[model samples]
Target: MSSTETATLSVPGANLSYTVRGSGPVLLLIHGGNGDANVYAGIAEHLAERYTVVTYDRRGYSRSKLDNAAKEYSLETHSEDIHRLLTELTCEPAYVFGSSAGAIIGLELACHYPGQIHTLIAHEPPLTHLLSGDEQVHARHIQENLEITAQREGIVPAIRQFATLLGLDQSNGSSGRPNVEQLERLLANMNYFVMREAPAIRRHTLDLETLKTVWNGASMRIVIGGGRASYGTFPYQCAVALARQLGLEIVEFPGNHLGYVHQSQEFAMRLHIALQD
Candidate 1:
């Protein structure tokens, strides 16, 4: 393993925090929601031996800060912030691995600015276009529940719902043991994303038009939801759809939506192999 250091960086609109570790090719590690840069800690360390892994807290999470002058943050701004980070750090176009919402941002960045990214491994983006009418309505309804829970029941329940929605509530999974206490702890800590960033999150919309416009010529691959993940889940469905539209093939990685957490070593090895030339 390589030495690790927690580093802070700033872009024009937001103050960002991340960890720079390892020592080879440049790789940007984007966290989904909840937690801080630590979400990618072990994964980054695993890759650090041969990659300069940059894992950071997006504007509103952990040590990163949102600027007072900014009129709320948008996904475009987040991607731009990352672009700025890459420019500050390396000349080589970096490989990117993003999960869940982070995956969504990675796709946007790759699409909007093709030359900056070498290859993007997007785990899942929760897009509805990959599904049909009934399933689409189901996903929208879930997003609606998140809105309602955050608004009506307070951030705690909303956080719980978010975790449960991602299949994190039951570590062994819905089929095995469920840790109620650990679930609540994560829910409390992750409330900031659900409350402060949820609104901005919904604005992300993907369709055939957006795909053609945004990701047309990008080097992108979607990692579909893996085994043990619910077969009828949104993330899996979304990956399937995005892969089809990109006219690229789908690759399977370890674990479910939270694979990076549930199976860190396996996920890391799979990640290295997936992005390996």
Candidate 2:
């Protein structure tokens, strides 16, 4: 049997909209930056079979709106939103699976509120703390691209830079697939979609200062690098560093950065295994 339901969660005056699919234990699927929880549509629907998949748009995006009179958005607020959503559900400890920036937010959730998560599968989180010289360079490169977008405010170069950071640069001869067209389409849509609400994500990030404040307090699974080729990439390094800091084992899932997109089937399979484990 397959099904989907939409609902609104009232948190501190904000009416947060979310969707639920499937049954069994709850698993909150959080999306990364430049995306809504819709990005997990492919996997969430399937995972719903064995899990109560929860996906929602971050406040200030899509259907969710903020009740608090905060002008700016921060990861701290985002983390609290998740906390309130879970609390309202009477589900204090649900398994959480997040990717990229969403993974960073999940980490924040665990830190901000302890024992609030059963298991968290952080797939290729760009935690940045584990970044080395080359990884730092790539990060700066992507940030530069974003700065360019903020300056010229055009999303094309930024899109290309995104592909580059995800190791999709044509110069690298990474893949035979055609991504330029897809990237172009993504940029065209963003102006009306994600880019329109830039302030929601403006200037916010996961840094050592923030992590140190919460890492020791929160119990979490710090997932990191696995593949032979991914030895020194940002995510892998982040996994290593986070595991060391948290004294947790590095759990390997699937892809490098955008595993859910690049290796969807394998990514989903690994994610399933991770959650099950």
Cα lDDT tens digits for candidate 2, 203-259: 445555555555555664444334333556665666676667656677765555555
Whole-model lDDT per candidate = 0.71, 0.64
Query: For every candidate structure, what is the RMSD over all alpha carbons to the true structure, in angstroms?
Result: 4.5, 5.5
**How many angstroms is residue 10 displaced in model 2 relative to the true structure, after the best TM-score fit?**
3.0
Candidate no. 1 TM-score = 0.85
Model 1 pairs whose backbones collide: 22-48
Candidate 1 wrongly placed segments (more than 4 Å):
170-189, 207-230
For model 2, what is the alpha-carbon lDDT of residue 15? 72
Which segments of candidate 2 are over 4 A away from where they belong? 12-14, 66-70, 132-134, 168-232
Model 1 residue 3 distance off true place after TM-score fit, in angstroms: 1.2
lDDT, candidate 2, residue 47? Answer: 76
Model 1: which ten-residue window has the lowest total lDDT?
169-178
